[model samples]
Target: MRRILALLLLAALGALAVWLYPLARPLARYGALPKGLDRPLNLLVLGVSPEYSGYHKRAPERFRGLTDTLLLVRLDPGANRVVVVSIPRDVWVNLPGHGWHKINAANPLGGPELSVRAVEALTGVRVDGYVMVSLEALRRAVDALGGVRLCVERPMHYTDRAAGLRIDLEPGCQRLDGAQAEAYLRFRKDALGDIGRIQRQQAFFQALKEQILSPWGLLRLPQAVAQAEPYVRTDLDRETIGRVLGFALKRPALVSLLLPGRFGNGWAVDQALWEEARRVYFEGQEVAPASSLGRVVAVVYGPGEEERAQEAARRLRAMGFRVLFRPVDQTPGRTEVLENGPGLLARDLAEALGVPYRVSGEAVLGADLTLRLGGDGRGL
Candidate 1:
C-alpha cells in the first residue's frame, strides 16, 4: 500500500515535472545531500519486492515479506576505497525497542528513517543516504543495459515455493540475463546459505555498477532513469543523483566490497560484532593488522623476473604492505583492491587497508621478492 502510493506519487510527479522540468533546479536543489563526505560513507541498500505488477493484477497481501537482500555500501572518496558490508537479511539482530529480530524488520518499524536509525545503532555509522530499490526496478535497469554479462563465481541452487523463485547453479563462470541475474540475487542455500547469497549480491551489484558505467550503458541512461524514477526510492535528490551519475560518467571505478567478517554457525549477527563492524567502518580502523595477519602480496610479473619480483615485494613492504605470503605467478587475476571489511583494519588507523591476497590459492615459487599475501595470523 505504501509502495503503491509512492509509485503513484512518482508518476504524477513525473507527469507534472516534465513540464515543471525547468522548476526542477530549485525543487531538486531542496533535496540535495551534502557532497564531499568522507570515504567509506555508509549507504543502506534494500532490495524490495515489486509493489504492483500492473493495474489489473491484484497485489500480494503481505507486509512482512522477505526483503532478503541487504548490503551496506562504504564509499571512501579520500582513500578511494569502496567497502561494502553484506548482512544476511535473515540473520537475526539485536533490534532496539523490540527484542531481537531480523534486521529487515527495521523498515516496517520505520521506512528509511527508522532503517537508518537501526543500522546506525547496529554499526554506529551515519548513513549518508538510502536507496530503496524495488526488485522490479533493478530488473528493468539490468534489462535496459541489454542484460548484464554476469560472472558466476560458483553454482547457485535454491527454490522458494512461497516466493515463487527457483535457481539452479552451474559451476565455473557464466553470463546471466536480467531475469537470470535476479534469480542469482534471489538464490541462497549454496554452501554459505544466506551468507553465500550476500556474496553473490556483491558481485552482482559490482557487475551492474560496471555495466551502468560502461559507454553503451551511458547512452541508454535515459531508459534507466525512467525505470528508476517510478520505482526506486532514495533520499538523494535529482541534483545529487545527477552529480553521482556524472561521477559515474567520469570516474566509473567505484569499488565493490563485502565486509570480511565471516559469520559463525547459525549466521546470526551478534550484538558485539555489530559494534565491531561499526568501529571498522566509522572509525577507519583495521580489523586485522598487516603485520600479523597472513596475506600474500605478490608483485605480479612475467617469467624470468624473479629478482625483479622480489625487489617489488621489498618495495611494497617498504611502502608498509604486509607481504606475508609472496608468490611468483606468471599469470594472475587482474589487480583488484579487495578488503575483508572492517575486520582487517589496523588499530589506531582511520581507514581500513586494502591488502593483497593469494591469487586463487596459488603459491609463488620464484621471484626477487615474491609478493604473496597469505596466511591466517596478523602481521607486525
Candidate 2:
C-alpha cells in the first residue's frame, strides 16, 4: 500500500507540472529586457475623449475626439531613466493630407497613426509604438489604485452643463477619487488656461508615479491594469507590456519636460530650443557648459527667505550665471527650480542646490531659470 501511494503522488506532481508549463513558458522567454527595448524606445501616448453633442450625449459610433493630452515618453533601459515630454494640444502643426491646424486635431482627422505621424514630423522623433487611452480608462485606473493624492495649488471652480463637467476643488493636499481626478485633469478655466492645465497634469502624473511606486500600489497594480485594460488601446504586445512593467518595478529615474514653445495666437515652437531639446532629451546628447553659462537666473523668495535667496543668487553668480532677485506672496513647502527653456540647467541647478526641479513656462518673465526658495530654503 505504501509503494502504491508513493507512485500516485509522483504521478500527480508530474501532471501539475505539465499543466503549469504553458503559463510559465512566456515568463522564461521574457525573463530579461526584450531585444526591442535594449536601446531607447519612444512611445506616443494620447489621452482621447469621445465626441459629444449637447446634453452630454456621445455619438453612436463613439468617434475619437481631440486628444486632450499628448505625451512623448522615452524609456531608456541603459540609463534606467524614463523621460516624459508633454506637448501642448494647441500647438500648431501641419497634419499630413491636411493643412495647418492645432496638434490635437490629428487624432480626430485620422487616428493614433496620424497623431504619431504628426508628432514625429514636429519633433523628428521616431515613435516605436502608441498607447491611446480613453478618459474612462483614467477613471478606472485611479479608482482601482484607491485614488491618488495631489496638492491643489489654488481653488478651482468650473462648470459646463452641456458637457456634464464640473470642477470645484479647494486649495489643499488630498486624495482624489476617480471622478475628482478626471475633473482635476480637465479643468482649464484658470488664468494660465491650457498652460495651467498642463502644469496640473504634470503634477498629477508625479503624484501618480509616487502612488505606483508605493508598496500598497504594487499590491493593487494587477487589479488596476486588469480594470483599465479594456478602455486602453495600445499597439504593444503582452510580452512587451510585461517587460515594461517589470522595468518600471525597478524604480528608474523619471524626468518630465514640456515642449519648448511660447504662447501667442497658438503655442509657437521655438525652433532652436526645440532642436536642442530633441538632441539633449531624445538623442541623449550632453548640454554644453558654455550653453548654460549665459542663462539669466532668477532667485524668487517667499516671506522671510530674502537672505537665503540672496545667498543663492550669489552662488549662482559665482558659477557664471547672471542672477536677479524676485519675491512672491505665496509660501512654498519645499524648494523648487523651474526652467523656462528647453535645456537641463534647472536640473543641474537643482542638483547643485539639493532640491527638486521642473521644466515649466511659469518661470519669472525674461529669466531662463527661476529658483523658488521655500520653507526648506531656511537651511541654506
Q: Where does candidate 2 clash, by residue pair?
A: none
**Lowest summed lDDT window (length 10), candidate 2:** 25-34
- The regions of model 1 sitting more than 4 angstroms off are 1-41, 50-65, 250-252, 260-281, 284-289, 292-338, 342-380
lDDT of 2 by residue, 1-380 (tens): 99999999999999766644443533443334433345677999999876676587755434378997999999988778888888999998888799899999999898889999999998889999998888888898899899998866677899987778889988666899888999999999966788778878877887898898798886676567666766777787766776686667668887777777777978787779878877877887876754558779888766667778888888888777998888755455467888755546887888887888876544665578888776653454
Worst 10 residues of 1 by lDDT: 358-367
The regions of model 2 sitting more than 4 angstroms off are: 1-36, 58-63, 291-294, 298-330, 340-344, 358-366, 375-378
Compose the digit string of candidate 1's lDDT tens values, residues 143-180: 76688766554556677655566687564335576678
lDDT of 1: 0.54
- The Cα error of candidate 2 at residue 334, in Å, is 2.6
